[model samples]
Target: MNLRVPTAWFLSGNRSDSNYTVGVNNTVVGFQESEDLRIAHDVITNSILVLIILGMGCGITLDQFKLHLRRPTGVAIGLLSQTVVLPFASFALAHSLGLETEAAVGMMVMGVTPCGMMSTVFSYWVDGDVSLSFTISILSTLLAFGTIPLNLLIYSGSWTDKQFVIPYSSILVLVGMTTMPLLLGIFIRWRLPKVASVILKIGSYAGILLVALSLVMLSVLYPFMYWASWKIYIAAISYPYISFMFGYVVSALFKMENFRRRTIALETGMQNFTLCFAILEASFSHVTSDVMSVFPLLYGVNVRTAGFVFVGIYKFMEKYGPKPVLTEEAHHLKHANNHRESFRLEDQQTSKGFLDSEAAEENGES
Candidate 1:
């Protein structure tokens, strides 16, 4: 369950360098295939994914979800912003930027995938409404199962130029890989809370190591990738920052509270990279390898870096920005003090009464 994010100091370095090409042939493992390194990196990514699911599962609870139903408008707004608005925006960005078709498709897929596990972490960090964030994340992901295929078909309709067709066999791929695991995680969380908690904690620590390992790879890998990145964006790294500012500004234009604003910001900024990666792995074939049409695997690192950057930013912002109200915490502190005072007063009264009663008894006996 250890799925810590890869480190993202690279966020500030230069996504625009276009110096780092991520083509199909450009294995992230570097020039030499080094099966050992490839296996290690694969293990890290898989662990990161498992940890992410575990953390998300641990963050969720079924008991009080119904309470939010009474305030359906907010829920609706959160949902609409996520599933509807976000996908369209992602498409627009990719299309207008004139991204290669697969890149555009991949970016759009990232948008459609829904709020990430980090949304909960960022929500809590930014003092945003964690419950609402979790609720929005879960609902949007549930909705994605139906909407993603539709979006993919619509956007990539002409893929082989002969009205490209899906094998329908891949539906099983989507379900088995993404949807089923997610549901399994949720079921475990609901039915076996302690197990979920342990998995989630492990995932969190794993995520940290993943981030560290990613950062190290980027440092070692970038200088050699100059040949492949000829046409990709020189400004791709900055997109996350721009996206954050835009989402924050847009959320603020509405009358949202501090925490909700944080939720919107982080949710809006981070893409679900795993979804895009899974689709590329599943849908594309080896024959189309170089002309494979999907983006270079290096983009995965970019996506991870962006998500982690926002998480760190949020962790810092949570301190100065809005926070969850301490109603329960305050109530408990007050109750404890009241109980203590009551105990002290009762002890004093009992002691005086006992003393007076003993004197009276002595007088009577005398």
Candidate 2:
């Protein structure tokens, strides 16, 4: 097997003394490639750790989870879209694009992974249903063990010749990673709000820094992925957009309100790519793992970039777009927000007046 150093990898400045023979799949692949791969892998490992901590510290609360549960219908629909629609869409997309075996598996892993905490952040930004987003994220994560393995087995069965074992143990690790911190955070929020707030502040700063480092590592890795397999890039770019649209259509068909539909769309589109990376790394051979990582890295880049653009569009529409014809429920929520704003202003004015009177009293005494 000829293992050419991909043009992109070669273009990324040399960090080693070793020279690689292009197109030879020798056991001793170049140190440079190994070194780059190791660095990227380390970055991913660290980022996952940070995100786990961050998700626990700041991403959710037990109350938020319970609130979502109060309305099971919407949350159930979101879960269906996540576990059923997204994986099928990914499998179909990979098949249609003729992605490499490893790449196809990577895509399926990404599709099957739970809704990321970032979806809730986006939901809050867009005035979407935050409870729904949180609910979908938490429930999907809790159920990922069953859904992930089943989806992968169903979708990628054709591609692998060996009896590719789904590592149930690793799924346990996933459950622990996602749940332990989450429950701890909820506990902190409930009992020690001050401590939780401090943790949230620190976690946000650290998460941002680690995320920046991870992006840099991924950017370096991207060029090394095959130019010949341009289809992977096409798939990466299109997958999230399609997922978003699919969620909207499904939600609309279910006759959900507009905000709930948008919430489902964001949840469906944003997956836990970090978890995908962890699963592939743990389950596959080194070479196969490296190859599989390409799709996730590409997706991590594309989804967020595209999501941000969509978020901007959402914000613009909220501010300047024609008023949406509101249902009674929607009208009630709008009136509630307006009422809250008025109360806040009145409180501020009362505080200001009290402070002024105290100051005047002090001045008279002087």
- Evaluated at residue 186, the lDDT of candidate 1 is 61
Residues 1-366, model 2: lDDT tens digits: 111243222222332223333433332233234565756567665555545464434434444454455447678887998899888898889899877677788788888888876675566456576556766877888788789878877887857744445556655665566566666765675576556556654554554455455567656645555332577889888988998898888889989889888889989898988678777767776556666777777788787777777678887997899988876434443332224343234334434545666688689999
Top-TM-score candidate index: 2
Q: Candidate 2 clashing pairs?
A: 2-23, 3-23, 3-24, 4-23
Error of 1 at 181 (Å): 9.7
Model 1 score (lDDT) = 0.51
Q: What is the TM-score of each candidate against the true structure?
A: 0.59, 0.70
Candidate 2 residue 342 Cα shift, in angstroms, is 10
lDDT for position 280 in model 2: 75
lDDT of 2: 0.66
Residues 1-366, model 1: lDDT tens digits: 111122111222332222332333442322333456646776766667556555544534333244335444445666666676766766666666666554555455566665555555545444455456656666666666676766666655423322323334444443344444455656775676556656655655666666677656544433222232323343245545665666566667776655566666666665555455555545554222222222333444555677677667766754687765544322332232224333234334434445666678689999
Candidate 2 TM-score versus the reference: 0.70
